[model samples]
Target chain A: MKKNHSGVRIGEVTLKWFIALHLSLIVNSLAGVASKMAGKQKFLSFRFCICYGMVLVITFAFALAWQQVLKHMSLTFAFTNKPITIIWGLIWGVLVFHEHVTWKMILGSAVILLGIMVGVSGDSGSDGSSLPPEGGKGDV
Target chain B: MFEGLGRYIAVWIVSVFISSIAQVMLKMEANREHASKLKEYMNPMVVSAYFIFFLSTFLTMYALKYVPLTYSPIIEPMSYIFVPVIGVLLLKEKISRRRLIGMGIMIAGIVIFSM
Candidate 1:
């Protein structure tokens, strides 16, 4: 049972680290915005390149941050928070895309989020570290 | 504003399928033995898997041109469903009851949300 200098346990992290991880998750979600913008541009156009390039940069950054976050936080915690991205997606759609929000969409998103939470918890419960990184999922 | 919406949905589904295959490829790579730790990550399989992911992302972006950003995330979990089913068939993996229930819930949610 080796403890880090921060007195954190193997799976425990400080609140600051937790917030940092969420920020990274939000950053990852922002790539979806860029993706949508890229989709609107002509393929291989300057604006398209810029938007897709931004997506790549954000993905790389999120991947790096995810590794760092995993070191400080347990996979269980990280996986649990992953579904929060769905909420973020909804928020971005409404605020950025100006898509109308219907009660049905909200309810459906809630159910999907709950299912992922259940499914991931079951998989990680047996062996947390054995699974591959799930960064690609829910990414635009 | 929604012309040829069916084709756009098809493109999104194809992207989801590609991404799911990439996920399975990653799992396959994880289950393999490499010469060294570095080789484990930098090998052909891992590299190709990521390349496939890139293709998927491009398709997703293309689909976004026609599909709503909000709707894309709703159906995005289709890949998650595909992975487990593919795993069960190709990898001979077992599905736990809890996992089954979760999948059911997700399907229900997708139905409700998109309906």
Candidate 2:
């Protein structure tokens, strides 16, 4: 039946997004390795090494958490929410690192949020009929 | 010491390869099942990503044996930012004005985040 086919198609798309979320984490890990190695070789300066190392630790933790999240959430929900890390980074910058949070920072966060909203709205509208009626995709 | 550099570079490349495989696996796994189907989660890609995921973790630990972590995360996100650019260029994906604005904001955030 058409309904069954649509259900299968929806499932397929949902799976793709899940893979994308996981791939994002994997790519992030690889980048961490590359940067660390670059710093060790002095291809990047010493100052860069310290900064890069902190990022590696943070991202590693995040990537691990993301793996667990992927086990439970839809890819679309998970990935669209990933950028919220910027908000956390902003908090870390202000609270821990004592960095400034300029108007630009606020503006950037707002724009990113807006874009995510728009994208999510578009996606949901297009796939409205295909998605499961209850529970739908799990939260990220 | 120079030999050590070569060794690290070799390890890094291997890590990249493994990480790429993990990415592909994760992608394939995501495509096959809804997140709600947690009970029925058996896919070759999921298995591969997990295997490589751990391998990358070890490789990362070894890498940290020589390199510092500070610079790693800064550069790490570069791929995430860059891959989309490649998609835009190679796949001919349209970059909407809103998305472009969003990317610009993200770039600025990255600079600030780096600082």
Candidate with best DockQ: 1
- Which 10 consecutive positions of candidate 2 chain A have the poorest summed lDDT? A131-140
lDDT by residue for model 1 (A13-130), tens: 6767878888998998888889899999989999999999998988888889988888876687787777677788888988999988889999999998888778767766445432
**All candidates: DockQ:** 0.58, 0.08
Q: What is the C-alpha RMSD of each candidate to the true structure, in Å?
A: 3.9, 12.8
Residue-by-residue lDDT tens digits, candidate 2, B22-104: 45345435545565666335555566656665566456546555533332323233333333344455445344554455556
Candidate 1: Cα lDDT at B114? 84
In candidate 2 the C-alpha lDDT for residue B50 amounts to: 64
User: Which CAPRI category fits model 2?
Assistant: incorrect
Which candidate has the highest TM-score of all?
1
Per-residue lDDT of model 1, residues B44-95, tens digit only:
8889889888898898898888787787557676765787787777778777
Error of 2 at B60 (Å): 16
* Whole-model lDDT values for every prediction: 0.78, 0.45
Q: lDDT of candidate 2?
A: 0.45
